[model samples]
Target: MGGIDNQKKFVLDWMDNHAKELSDWHQVIWHFAEPAFREYKSSAWYVEKLRAEGFEVEAGSGGMPTAFMAMWRNGAGPTVATYVEYDAVPGNCQAATTRQEPRKGLSKYAPGHTDPHSALGMSALGGALAVKAAMERFGIAGTLKIFGEPAEKVRASKPIHAAKGYYDDLDAAVSFHPAYMLPMVNTTIWDTHCGVGYNYIYTFTCDAPQDWIASDKYSPIPQNHLAARAPGANDALIHFYTLNESLRRSMLPFTGLWSFNEAILTAGQATADNLTPQISQIDYMLRTDSIEQAEIISNVMDNNAEAAAKATFCKWKKTWVAKSRPGLANHAMAQATYDNLILVGAPRWDETAISVAQEIQRNLGLAPMEKPFLPATERLTSPQECERLMRKQMPEWQRYLTSDDYPDYTWHCPTVRLIVARPMLSAPQGYTYPDWVANALGGIPATIDPMIQSAGKTIGATLLDLFTRVDVLEAAKVEFEERTGGGVGGSKWMAPLLPKDFKVPHQYRWPEYVTTARGEEWTIPYRDDE
Candidate 1:
């Protein structure tokens, strides 16, 4: 609990030797910058890389074309796990430069890594591979598995993996993410863990627009205002979104951080005239502190869709994007990870990293200070303090406060959600920075490598302790069992939110890059001819 062991040292040193390689891969993913459910190049590179490392790779593990699971075992021992998420957010295409601009040769609407999942993926890959090397050199006995999770921004993949029993055999899971906002940076979660989220799509079709009149006895003139064509899909979508917004307060108590947001996947399907705008799609993603709260919000949404469809003479169907469980706390696991984090210490920014931050400030028309990054970004927050700060606004009875699908792993086995600081700048007094600032910082190698390097070292150290220390492993298992009321199949245990036979909604129209006559572009422009 105090100092690093010889075995742990091996993995940390492993980070030192392979740091550049990991950073190089980070840039590779940044350049790929593929959107949710469309990480073709990103996922393929990871698959090939894992195979080259002698992993028994499953290219499409959970029936997702871009998801993968790679495993390597060394004799008989405890099996621990970790994962990589490489999906980017669409419309976040700012380049990794001081000025606001899209990456070269791409449109401003192209997908980009906002969370900079680019570094998140590399951090875990570096950690696991380091453990793999240490396993051989130190004759450590255990199994190591790394999952390639795609479409994380959509909250996809992991729930499917959980239902398919992919996580059923694991003894532990270590989750690493870049520090997005407060208290979570450089700490493990003690309590007040991540909340639950539900994502769904409502599709409306105006198939019977012509039958707006009773028995279709009335004649209808095409493309004429006098003809009273049915209100159509576009009108129905408007009804649902507007109705949902009106009832937003009644859907929940409005006492905690609970809300739903929407995205219009397709509005009029590019229909030029009043061919009744045949179909439309809208996506809703809601997060709450409890499954009960999620259910409360979901019911209102379903009813709203029904009413909206009926009013506009359209029929609709609901498609689930993802249904994720709230994270369960494992004090033993949290403590172990925090101990390792303290050993690694906080991320240290050098002159180069600082200079990049200063450039960003200057571009924003603010005077750059000697230290541009937030102090919290570099300071360590203990697990207890994180919980206290997280619970400050919530009621005493509420147990969770945020949202993520990673919690799905906690139900199956012990999981530790780890975070290392990505470079977050300290703004001038009363001047808030724009999102593009953070996005740009994430992509620049000089600024982000410090956080990436820290994660690799911290993750490797935690995994090594799990493999070699029986006491640490058993303690985690004990806490996990207690939380789940005897673990996996117990009375308090919650099964995967998505059914085992649930189909992934990859058919939805998500923004993606395409190869054109010119070359690969963000999305092809509208065309009349093939």
Candidate 2:
């Protein structure tokens, strides 16, 4: 840690040296803005760069066409795996200002870096290059792995990378993201990858008289066609407002639907219209810090989707999607890491001290008070009695209302909230956009630039330094043994064993489905009861 100045200088210098290249990479990626497995251009771009860098590059290794793995080795030593995400939020083309309006509606879909995942790829590239340079300059013996992961907005698909045995041989993994401030560590834990569960998207096509509807005689046939386009349509905001009201009344008990709802609404207002309204297809994953809560929330989700679909007369489709291993849980283990960061040198650590430091951070325009890694049961309880109990039992929640990252106060997080205003231009008479796509469009940059770079750099460097100090490489050995009940041999790595405790992950096939050539028999593969 004594070399804090030097290390900071090195990282900054590295970023500066690579700025042109990184920005080029960023711009290229920003321009393409591919989504998930469909990231052909983005993937090819990275693969070309990685190949030129003399790393062993493998394309289509993870049962995914868009995903790839690249590795470089200096000597026989511990393996460290890093990840890069290149998928763009679908259908969000815009001018590069911090604004929420599309310059003009796109004819063909033009993926935008609204999510700034391009920044993700750049960070991974930058960090990996820096570490490789460090290892070489210092003559350190270790293996450096950089994995190209896809589709984070929904599935998070990292578990798929795990299943591909991507992390199977790694000593440890590191990821840096763009955000508003340096969080010592992110507390929104619980990375639960789920199987593609099905819900009945019962489309009650209004079979009214021709004059009854404003549009043409729309049939269920064309419905599926425009469904995926829902994320890019003008009705997206209405969808957000409507869903918010719907969930406000009928949201299930102890479910993080509220969080999901808030995230969606924020996305809609800040991003695009297609994002919220024409949610013809719902692809959602449930995550929380507690496994018990995760399970309860999952059950609630299944029940709620089923109930909603049945009520709507939608047919059920069961699509087997794989959920990632639970998100990085922030229980005792993670908390210990936070506490350890304090034991080292953070500006402040304790609640009171941290609170004051948080104010300073806010003054600096950094997002304050990282979202708490709370359990679903506690956070999702919408009962009036629970609200009353909170006032009496956890007045701290009340105290922090002025500025707290409580689970219930998710929307209050300025970073998470998206402010909506009428677009400068009038909507074209026939103009439409995807709801979810648009929601993501407007707000994604806030997560990356100046925000994520500042936050991620500070936190990532601190974490890496701590790991180096505490001998995290060795600790991971013990952690693997204790958590997996396995020995600390080379097998003591990151992949989850199947049947016993893990299983092959489900694949995501979105916006595409199989059907008869005549279009008579429909096969909506992404449906709830497929």
Per-candidate clashes, comma-separated: 1, 55
lDDT: which candidate is best? 1
lDDT of 2 by residue, 1-530 (tens): 34455544565456556645655566677666566556777888888999998789888656667778898888887666656777765445554433334433332234455436676567667757765665666565767777777666544345555544455465655444432111112321221111221111111111221222233335443333333322221233334235535654664443332233212211113433322222233444444333344455455555555554443323223332344332221122233333322322211122433343344334434455452111121112112232344345332322211111112111110011110110111122364333433233223332223322332343334333433434544554455455444542234222331222332232433432134664421122222233
- Model 1 / residue 530 / CA error / Å: 18
Give the C-alpha miss distance for residue 131 in model 1, angstroms. 0.5
lDDT value, candidate 1, whole model: 0.87
Candidate 2: where is the Cα deviation over 4 Å?
1-12, 98-111, 180-282, 288-315, 328-472, 475-530
TM-score of each: 0.96, 0.54
lDDT of each: 0.87, 0.42
Looking at model 1, the pairs that clash are 195-402
Tell me how many residue pairs clash in candidate 2: 55
